[model samples]
Target: MAYFSVRNITKRYAAHTALSNVSIDVPEQSIFGLLGPNGAGKTSLIRIINQITGPDEGEVYFGNEKLAPHHVDRIGYLPEERGLYKKMKVGEQALYLAQLKGVSKADAMKKLKYWFEKFEIQAWWNKKVEELSKGMQQKVQFIVTIIHEPSLLIFDEPFSGFDPINVNLLKDEILNLRKNGATIIFSTHNMASVEELCDNIALINNSHKILEGSVKEIKKRFKTNTYSIDFDGFTGPVNPLLPGGFVLTEDKSDDDLRQVTVTLPATATQNELLNAFMPYVNIHAFREIIPTMNEIFIKTVHAAGNHSINS
Candidate 1:
């Protein structure tokens, strides 16, 4: 069952329709990726999920209960647009924010100390926010967001402005949170990150949900029957050996291996593709080319009649 669910939500601002009957089900203790291009209604849906705004039509649920303002304490949100009081001491601000989320000051400080040490920011505790770098400030924000130990966490562009090392650190922390029973709602335009982190995803385009499924399932669904074969010692024209309706897309040589990629029609299988080349060359290896998340994102968005999505 979904720990958090948005059911046919619709929202509008003035004359602009920001969202139209969008729905998503975020399973418990899992990372659910909410993906889309800018102005594709992702922010609107997130707002509804966080109760920042109510939808014009449709109901929302937090577990068995209908969504309400009281549930705000159960969710932790780290928005893309980050802010902190530049003059406030780093430790003071983190403690204040955590208390606002209903945590006792003592507990908040205890949690903050653990996280600060874990993130190697213990030295920054007494420093003013302005004295820290952008990435350092982001670390503070991340700490406060989860300090309350909310059951659901929503992170929008969580990895922004960080170097590769910091990004990996945050990724590891996110996984640890899930392992400890926090369901995460993650939104980002970085497809490579999505491939690495998301278990399930919903793609929004033109204010509608265009695709939704587990990462592995969706990738399997988007297969194009493309295969790559590596061989050497073939001294004949490539086209002559190919069976009818086979498409040869790539041919190259790397070291001692000569590789070729082919697209097979429904009438043929990998066995048939292999059989044709078996007698003529020394086969090295062969493998199917599964579509990457970025490729699937671009292809799906284009096929849905929308363009300019992040690839």
Candidate 2:
């Protein structure tokens, strides 16, 4: 069974519909990417999961049981909008937040110390939050969020303010949390991060889920059967060898190597294309050009927009 499941959830604020019959399952100990453009109801679904607000219709399940008020303590949420008391001492604020998440003061302090040391921010513990740089403040908030070791973690743009080094540091920690059996729902606009970290993804568009699948499966499904080939010498009229169903998209030569990109018809297999090209050129390398997450996102959103307009 899925560790967390949002089942046919719908939310409305007066006349505005924020989410429309959205449903997704987060498997245990996996990194699930919650993706969408701004104002596409991603935050609405997240808020509902956090129990900051109730859904107008449908249900959420944690394991086999339905979600309840008491379940709030089991989740750790780091919102895109940072919220830390500027005037409060870093350690003091972290402890207070950790306690709110149900960790005892003593345990919170112990965990906080470990995290501070690991992040090399022990010197900043006594400093007021406002004294730290934006990235440092973000690190403090992140430490507070995970101190209690919640089962389900929701990170909405968690890497927003950090430099690349700190971003990698936090990513490593997130991966560690998953390794220790935590389920994560990561919401971000960074498609590269999604490709690197997410096991599964659900893409929302205009308050609805337009795409949902494992990252690999989704990419494969959206592939246009494109391939890239590199060859040497023997450059006879390359266009003649190209099958009727294949479209040559790009052709270039650098020194002795010739590179070409071909988009095949749906029915064409890689083997067939390879066989046809082998006789014309000394085949050096051949590879299918799978679509990137960014490409898929743009294509899907554009298609959805066109569908909406036509309908």
Candidate 3:
């Protein structure tokens, strides 16, 4: 069974549909990305999962049972917007939040101490949250979110306000959490982060899910069969000897080295392309140009928008 499942979920606000029959299955202990454009109902689905709002239709399940109030204790949420109490001391506020998630005050302290030292924020413990920088407060919130060792964690743009070093720090911590058997649902506009952390992803567009799959499988599915070959001392215009299905999209000469890009036909193979180019030039480098998550996001969203318009 999936660790978390959203089954045909729908949510509406008056006449505007926030989500429409969206469903996704998140496997156990994996980092699942909940992705979409702005106002595409990713937040709505997240709200439903958090039990902050009920869906108009369908159901969500965790483990073997249907999600219920008790399940909230096992879930942690870190929103994009910081929610720490400004007037309270950082340790006090963290302890409060951790206890709310069902940890005892004593246990919370022990855990907070470890995290505070790990993050090197022990100095901020007694300081009021209002005095800390935005990034510092985010660290506090992150510690609080996981202090109870929740089974499920939902992080919305968790890297907000973090510098590159802190971003990498948090990324490593998150990966460690998954390694320790916690399930995560990550929602973000940062496609690069998605590529690095997500094992699987569901792309929601205009209140509907348009794409969902393992990151590797999705990348493979969208491959254009394009390759860039760099060779030293290649002759001018090798196009005349090109295979029937190969389309030469780019040709560039950088001093002594020549590089060309070609799109392979469905029936063609990389070996065939290499054979055609060999003997004429000394091949120095060759690589397939796989699409990045950013490219896939843009292409898929734009395609969905165009389809909506035409239909």
Q: Where does candidate 3 stray beyond 4 Å?
A: 309-311
What is the C-alpha local distance difference test score of each model?
A: 0.92, 0.91, 0.93
Which 10 consecutive residues of model 3 have the lowest summed lDDT? 302-311
- Local accuracy of candidate 2 as per-residue lDDT tens digits, 68-132: 98888889999999999999999889889988888888888889999999999999989999999
lDDT of 3 by residue, 1-311 (tens): 88999999999999789998999999999999999999999999998999999999999999779999999989999988779889999999999988888899999999999999999999999999999999999999999999989999999999988999999999999999999999999999999999999999999999989999999999999999999999986677878858897899999888788899999998889999999989788999999999999999999999999886321
Q: Residue by residue across 234-287, what tens digits does model 1's lDDT show?
A: 856687889999999988889988899999997789999999999999998999
How much lDDT does candidate 3 score? 0.93
Could you report the Cα RMSD, in angstroms, for every candidate shown? 2.5, 1.8, 1.4
How far off is residue 301 in model 1, in Å? 1.3
Looking at model 1, the pairs that clash are none
- Which scores higher on TM-score, 1 or 3? 3
RMSD of 3: 1.4
Highest TM-score among the candidates is held by which one? 3
Residue range with the least summed lDDT across 10 consecutive positions in model 1: 302-311
